[model samples]
Target: MEVATRYARQVAVIGVHSPKFSAERDPANLAAALERHDVAYPVVADPDLTLWNQYAIRAWPTLVAVDARGRVVARHEGEIALPDLLESLRPLRGPDGFVAGDAPEDASGDEPALANTLRYPAGILADAARDLLVIADTGHHRLVVASLDGQIRFTLGDGVPGLVDGTGDRVRFRWPRGMAMLPDGRLAVADTGNHALRLIDLGAHTTETVAGTGEQARHRMSGPGAARETPMASPWAVAWFAGELWVAAAGTHQLLALDLEKGTLRPAAGSGAEGLHDGPLAEAAFAQPSGLAVAGGRLYVAEAESSAIRQVDPATGRVRRLVGRGLFDWGDRDGVGDTVRLQHPLGLAADPDDARPILSIADTYNGRIKRLESETRTVARVFGGGDREQGEMGDEDGVGTAARLRSPAALAVAGDRVFVTDTDNGVVRVGDLATGRMNVLRLEP
Candidate 1:
């Protein structure tokens, strides 16, 4: 996109994620391709056009014009012409909008333009919104929260060493590993240390334990002696889907689906706690299930020892392998003779705006993120692989960050931003989902 077209504002562009596009679609290359020689303003590199499909765009460059009510007023598509671009941008230009090309409604929506900054530099990964970014500073044994502009919103769970109802409130997270958003706008933390699900009420500014009052795992049952029935065995990842909370009970080697509203738990895709199969629940199991992400009524799980990404059909306990050749097989590629396999994969998420429910896998050992199109089970390489240093796709060294991202462990995507829990360096790196540029949401430069 020409910098002039979306100058001083934000806009997202969509396209099919073809090898041809990823190869030639580098941001630096975009300016040259567009004949600007140089350009600014992020051009959301949506290879799958996830946003396009969901937002109902007929073609590329379908600009969704939002109103103050956060509703899309107009949509422009197909190599937007100058006149069409101007027309699509009219509402955001006047005094009513926040920035250039920003819709009138989005102007005052929930996201804050300025990001809050903190002193934690070792941020390994971050998950957040325009208003909030959760940093998983692993080395520090704590999770950090900041505003959209990188402002230090607050660092949470800095105290205690237990997992239970009384371990700690929002202020204390015991080595929290991952973060997720609740339906009510509250924040959920995989208080890893305590082996529990922690909740943070954004409105109340208070923290509480929503699940696993005790630091242990068990099956979910109802009634009478059912108090401790809903247990998670070393639960590592958490996801909100279909109005329920799902946990990867690594300790038990099973996926525990919880009805957060009713406080009920049940064996979801796997019956028993250990095994990998489409057979009955008990026959199916996992080897240290870690990352958990939900989209389009399906759940994705990252099996560490097994080295496979398992897809779970929520309604029926059906399971299938999305990636990897076999259990404990570490290769460079897949199907090409045991090569290109995931090494110690951890975090996982689905591209919301995409039609394929693409699974973004943080191949931890590979230091890269792999986008797996669930529909076809094909994989595309994104930020990561052999060079874990810093930059858009810099997790090449068995660590997630190229430079700013020291070790990305978790994934969170809200609105137009993508966050990673850069645990090693102890800081969360927030970037624009479209441009993939390092976005610091703080008051400081």
Candidate 2:
């Protein structure tokens, strides 16, 4: 985004989306994703992978730089640092190099204000004990705290994207994602876009930076370092387990651990490689792990890129795959173990009310909420699902498979109800776990 803004006059950025999942091929879903991410540039949806085949693209994100005359100039696979990218483009700045144009007009000013509505909420947590619902209003760059009945309690951040630690509205966050409550009642946040971890004290209305250097890590592998000194790479989700905070470092394709007592950060699992290999912590690989939950005395990960669920043994640092086949195997199918298929699931929560370990999943691409029984190894749809042709797969309240959702990113189970961040729809949805009935949660101040 910074690159596009910085070189707007000299560069014309166009996004070509080659979807890996069928649901992503839907024009509505694609449009919703663009808006949710605040993508200003025009995007071409290559649902048939025409562009992928023509360009021989082998990765999810392959940047192909085309010159003003339409000749391919350079190409890069995977993430690149902004500074490096800017430096590489320096040669194409002068006359006869690249064309310049006026900046695009901002169309957002014409849109009506949606003060009470969430803008692309990405993560949610329901504290049954406290009767509180916490939401990561990702696009708005704020965290909202509300009562279970939809009454506003308090909030964190000032609706701006940055890295600042202070009290209430004085604090700032950038596209915060998953959250976990500390044993002492403080809220731990994966300040994703800021590449940092933050702590929120609800009673004090204060926020503190616990880890990260407020900059994205350029390197793939990161070692133990002082919490505030460590440069993190897109810490997407966080979970508290065994006296440590576990982080799903999505950009690095690894799991990280933060020791609150020692105030240190270290890699916990994955070797910074992007794949579906599982074994010892150092040798194990992950594909954009985006969600974390603790269940059955183990940590479960939502591996988004592979559309898989994984289990990690905290005692031995051993990783194992629970569901999904590989990077290409994805769908909206339910069964047991490896027979089940998920489409880029991103949210996971352990059911606190169940005696046996049961996981609630926000199957993002499938637009559904699912349940996984740890003991039986059975997967079942809990809510969501509808007809795509009829446009029923988005922003509709119903029961069971009749309910509609668009890219539900995160969910939390609170006793008899489940709270979901219907991300692309920009709303928080609440569902009755027993009845499968779902409705949009209207927040009120």
Candidate 3:
């Protein structure tokens, strides 16, 4: 029998995040229990645990009952008997207002949000030769290349801002992200913090201006920030595919493909906008597009605000929804099982072997990365769901002081080696793909 006579209304609520309320975690026959009682309201199938991270779910099935006025009159944790559930409602009919978590400013002047930080920040991947691993150190505003053993092999931007490093003397990158090794082993960077993308020389440490002709915000991207009529505006993510480099322009809402040899870009639609496209790809635009990757002629993009995963038809430049609707709902923190709503996500990649064509997404806000199977979109792996700086990183380092991740913005994988930026920790961390284990690269001053 349905609880037809029970409470029924759209109640504003907040709940826990991913780590504590993982979807892959078996519910202990919770669904059967709910069904036995005929309770419904779509208790929210949040596989990624977005609500768990948001409300900081202290207790399982914690209850916060709000009155008709949107105030929380009663909050009970654990299982509340029906009589008590009704007893807690007495305040709703009274004069007392509901209780809200809104509080006064904290002592440090920092607004309180999630109670976690970054334990790992950067992820690394390699080329065909495993000659190098690339990292986008956004907070530091630089792109780093390291050895297989994690040594500082090379650094780009020279700690200066500019598209061409010393060539222009003014082409600086702001919050740089996304790096790809071209067929020739050259590196392409999405300098998000700087509003431009640069191509770096792996051997010489020289920076080349590839797009967004200017170093600042510009609506049209021609070549670099210094150029006119270019389409790049705050490019955040990049990918190399079929002899072309693709950039996800977060500012102007577009996907740009560049000829690595020619360094020229053309707008790509992936899938036509709205429904049917009768115009050029440039006519189509992405909404807050953050991360991009390509495999088997298909393009996968992560739109943060839209909270969706989309597939791009490379032939027509048309884009279509593959996962989220960009609504920020609760789902998967990683792309492994079911995709989840995110706070902000910034990385995407497909396994190179073509055996599975699996895609990996770094669900930054939920503090983990998820792997999804190809085309079918089933989750294959989920890791790093607890992205807080716990004062300690990598169990092997033994710094174990409750360290959590700060905000991991990017990721890269080669073999079983994974890398993280540890944005707040101000160092790059390393992990093993086999055991889901972690170790710090220790990039501190």
Q: Point to the candidate with the largest TM-score.
A: 2
- Give the range of the ten consecutive residues with the poorest summed lDDT in model 1: 105-114
**Candidates' lDDT values, in order?**
0.55, 0.86, 0.54
TM per prediction: 0.61, 0.93, 0.61
Candidate 2 lDDT, 175-228, residue by residue in tens: 899999999999999999889999998999999999998889988755799989
Q: How would you encode candidate 1's per-residue C-alpha lDDT over 80-142 as one tens digit per residue?
A: 444556667676566653344532221111332222222222222333333565665433345
* After superposition, candidate 2 runs with Cα above 4 Å error: 90-115, 353-355, 387-392
| Candidate 3 to truth, TM | 0.61
Residues 126-158 of candidate 3: C-alpha lDDT, one tens digit per residue: 553765766664433455566656555655543
Candidate 1: stretches off by over 4 Å: 1-130, 138-141, 163-170, 218-231, 280-282, 334-340, 386-407, 415-417, 430-445
What is the clash count of model 1? Answer: 77
Q: Which stretches of model 3 miss by more than 4 angstroms?
A: 1-125, 167-172, 215-231, 261-263, 270-285, 315-317, 328-340, 386-404, 443-445
| Model 3: per-residue Cα lDDT at residue 8 | 31
- C-alpha lDDT (0 to 100) for residue 382 of candidate 1: 54
Model 1 TM-score is 0.61
Worst 10 residues of 2 by lDDT: 105-114
